[model samples]
Target: MKNQQLQSKGYLMISSTQTIRIISINETFDPQGVKIVYGQGTFSHYSKDGLVEDSIAYRAKGAAAVSVAEAGVNASGVAIGYLDIEVKDSDKGYKNKICTLVIRSFIPTTTANTTFVPTTSAPISPPASEENSKQLVNPVPTVAASNGYVNTTDSSNIPF
Candidate 1:
């Protein structure tokens, strides 16, 4: 904290306040084929007036590092911990640049084949599941019940 010496009667001067906001963030899961037991992290907002190391035009590009110190369960049911994320400013003082978050997929080479065949049989066919579509059981028929259907029952037959 910087302080200015008080003159005559002791008093403070030049009080300033700053506000920060998160522009964009890219966060993804990293599964190492293990189960994560716990998860904890932190993020930061970047601005010229904040505690950023460097900034300009009241805006700065920065990132907040986060870690899953304890670990937790992920979508793949793998034990993951020590998660890390960086808090970064999007503007970076460039007016023409558009800010966006990106998540990259990690692909492994030397992949192994899961299924085996005699080179004559075709690959397994995907079975139709409920997620693919909803089964219509005893469906109620309608001439035009749903929305966006225009009724053309003629002017004379039309009931007022």
Candidate 2:
């Protein structure tokens, strides 16, 4: 082995493989109300002669495609932010070797399509009153943040 290509003692190499790899990512989302969201898991590294830098820069195209999108009134995807990776090699019990990455997959854009043809037109239903119209609404009003919540994922928000 060459003197410049040797691994150091202590937490070096991903697991004694003499090539410990470090990773970085953007784990959260800032969907400016586009009705859609996307994420990518980027990773890359070149073996160093010594201590590895804590932060690595990912190529703009290096970000892996998370290709997740949802549409509709109240839709959402994965939690936004970094990727949570678990690494092990008889070190630190293989727990939390990497930081917790949250996936920002929720981006509110448009609501449900109103043009959906009614199922069987209610057989010549009588004109709906103001109170009745309110009740007929598909989504019941609640304390939902004018912004959607992660508790539920509605249609249109999903690529399907």
Among these predictions, the greatest TM-score belongs to 2
- Where does model 1 exceed 4 Å of error? 1-79, 92-112, 117-160
- What 10-residue stretch in candidate 1 is worst by lDDT? 69-78
Query: Under the 3 Å rule for N, CA and C atoms, how many clashes does model 2 have?
Result: 25
* TM-score for each of the candidates: 0.14, 0.16
lDDT of each: 0.29, 0.32
Model 2: residue 70 alpha-carbon error in angstroms = 9.5
Q: lDDT tens string, model 2, 92-121?
A: 565434433333332323323336765754
Candidate 2, after superposition: displacement of residue 107 in Å?
A: 1.7
